[model samples]
Target: MEIATYILVPFILFALTGLKVMNEYERGVRFRLGNYSGVVNPGLRYIIPVIDTMQKVDLRVKAVDVPSQDAMTKDNVSVNVNAVLYYKISDAKNAIIEVEDFKFAVSQLAQTTMRDIVGETTLDRLLSERESVSLRIKELVDKASDPWGIKVNSVELKDILLPSDMKRVIAKEAEAEREKRAVIIKAEGETIASVNLSKAAKTLAGNKGALHLRTLQTLNDIASDQNNTIVLALPLEILESFRGKNK
Candidate 1:
């Protein structure tokens, strides 16, 4: 009885060691005698003890944050840029076979591709056309990583850091542009006001009594403020009219 108990214990241990349970998101790449075998789907899987090995890979979308890279723009501007990369493993077999480390490979590929795309783009376009540039980087990286079984979902430019001096220069240029527009608008307003004043003057001159009526209206406006005193100067036309009335 003691000998049978010892033997069964060893057999139970070996059987437990061969049993593997994979989650829903996991796939097991099985190798038999160091040769490519088949992929084990999510469930209880059995492997021969000391003969077959399995590597579990999670088939899930992953986000990798690329560190900031110092890049020079096409317009000769220096900037620091960072981005995020979204990717997934399309073919798990190729991912494990074609690359030593698929995640690291994709990350490095994204970094270099970002720098290359940034170098090709001017500073103005890089600042303005972020979506287009990100799509371009995604396409290039996706195409390059196809053999490695990585599908690049999307790429996003997160932040762009410019030099302090460049920021100040941009601020000053914007201020100057705003001032220029203000001056132009003020000049246009003045030109319109001058044209209107000239028309008013011509109308007042052609119509008799218009000037006197305007002067009376000004005096009435000034008199509306009870705290103010006004001096009225009668024009020569008023005196001539009075003289004609006396005659």
Candidate 2:
């Protein structure tokens, strides 16, 4: 009975101390007595009870929110902007060894990088240059975090918060631009119409019968408008011939 008790007690202790379970999306980093140790694969793992410590790291993509930062543009405009970062741990060993807190370091780095980018661009560029801005930010973040085994997949500017007065000014400026374009388009159409009319007039003047036909067409168009009042202008020679024929 005493032998049985000893065996059962040690079995229970081992089971409680050495057993570790890792999910499919997690990997465990094992260290022994302050020395570099290998990574533990996903599944059950056994460690020497107190001599080894394990860190469970998630392998899946992580989404981090970059808080709003007030940044001054190159044009001396102040804007508040916030962004999102999609990242993942690429090298588990380096991630464990290089940084004490990789996540916080990355977050801080992103903010500073964003500010730097904003400082280099004007407000118009910052607002209009989305693809370029995102690409630059992602490249910078990835380079900065490479030492920490962090891979920045993509960076996106989620929101740009501008002042109400700035919004109003921008809107007005946009409206003016649209109005200018409209005026230019209308003028172009009028020029085209004038050229077309001049060409038609020249063609009709070459044909003697075209003027009469065109005049008849104009009268027909006016009659089709369902109006009763009509005014006719006849040449003096034609009116005189008509009076002599009637007499």
lDDT per residue as tens, model 2, 1-247: 9999999998888768888988989888899987769898888889877788889889899999988999998998889988999999998888999999999989999999999998888899889997688789889999999999999999999898888999999999999999999999999999999999999999897875887789888878888897787768585459769999999
Off by over 4 Å in 2: 1-4, 226-229, 233-247
Error of 2 at 163 (Å): 2.1
| Structure candidate 1, residue pairs in collision | none
> Poorest 10 consecutive residues of model 1 by lDDT?
227-236
Count the clashes in each prediction.
0, 0
RMSD of each: 4.5, 4.1
Give the winner by lDDT.
Answer: 1
TM-score of predicted model 2?
Answer: 0.88
